[model samples]
Target: MNTMTLWHITGWEFAALAFAALLVGFSKTAVSGANTVSLAIFAAVLPARASTGVLLPILIAGDLLAVATYRRHAHWPTLWRLFPAVAAGVVVGTVFLLWADDAVVRTSIGAILLLMAAVTVWRRRTADKEEEPESVTTRPGRLKARSYGVLGGFTTMVANAGGPVMSMYLLSAGFRKLGFLGTSAFFFLIVNVSKLPFSAGLGLIDGRSLLLDLALVAFVVPGALFGKWAVHRINQRLFEQLVIAATVVGGLQLLLP
Candidate 1:
């Protein structure tokens, strides 16, 4: 970090970051919110503030791969409904970042991840109780979308933690596997891309961070390919259980000293 070199970190740190990058791709293609692990890893490895910027481009790379793999199954109307609220949330997040210190950012992100994990678990448990799932077009559904969209945008801006929030929203809206993957692909791609200016303006996405990302991004390709190959064969229940467990551990790590 003092040297500002791409290889400034020790070998083990780089290995951890490389694995996290791979998870970013895998999460993009297979489990939607699973990258919460990657977010935690990146924040743990890099400075809390710099971690978000470093991870953004990597997430974008994964997003591109996801969109390419699941382009046809997206639900556009849902994405459209969430965008305006999400944009407002991003602005609010940006304003928050202007004053938040690294400790505050780290704590906020940790809390958000834990909260999102809880929400996901609750959604899953209650899923079978609903006789009819709400559509995004319903009056209640629009309110839900706005609420989740704002929260998603705020968290994504603050810590690249939007995935779980959006995942819950999509699940509550009743998306099946393919539609879920496709819609999320486009959603993150657009949202993350739009965040570039804000990150750069914040000095988070600097040349040094980009250099580190260059080394880490190569690992994402294979992870994404593996996800694409395994998506159909993977057991849905098992996959989500693992993701939630990992996310909980990550959140706890971030929260503790």
Candidate 2:
């Protein structure tokens, strides 16, 4: 394995990486859907093939902070329901990664992101037609769970963009306020942790990746702290709107030729 030098990181690149790190922290704490932007920024700054490896550790660091802040809020049932399907999808994605061209992966990620954004917007419109529920539902319908579980698993495994997919599913299923946050945190924590062995097996977690992660870790702390503060103040409708818009833009960028 060769050492990755600081020379690869020009001032602008460093700024991009730092900004991405901050977004990672914020996304982990406040809105899981914003990870699409962080994914795009990281891939832009690093080799597309190596970006996932480089970003995973930094994400895990941010995950730890999120879990600490929102552990008690997680909806364990939803997490459990999504686990098996997600694991299977991760295995399938790992196999695909072993042979897929970088361009194919990028295009697939972009397409999926665009698809998810459309679904989210459409779902929101449909939800608006229904009366405001007196209570939130934690148990997603079986068919809905399976649909989201498969898509979330495939997207997250391939591009680390499953947040939007799952967010749409949960939103459509009618989780509100803390239930949404809790379910998202638990789902991602399990999915991200599950990805470790696959990432290592694919040679994505080398020393160079670790060194880069170390540099990015500092930025996550402040970003997460800010996200924690922001989550409480932001209205649920406004937050979802912002997340959808971000996802649409990130997906298009990834798809660019």
Number of the top candidate by TM-score? 2
lDDT of the candidates, in the order given: 0.82, 0.79
Task: Supply candidate 2's per-residue lDDT for 33.
Answer: 75
Per-residue lDDT tens digits for candidate 2, residues 144-177, read 7777788788878777878878877777777665
lDDT tens digits, residue span 1-257, model 1 = 23264346789999999999999889899887778888888877777777888999999999999999999888888899999999999999999999988778768767877887788788788766433322222222778889989989998999898887787677666666777788899999999999999999988888888888888899999989988987888664665675567667666766876
TM-score of 1: 0.89
For lDDT, the strongest prediction is 1
Q: What TM-score would each prediction reach against the true structure? A: 0.89, 0.92
- List the pairs of residues colliding in candidate 1: none
Q: Distance from true position, residue 244, model 2, in Å? A: 1.3
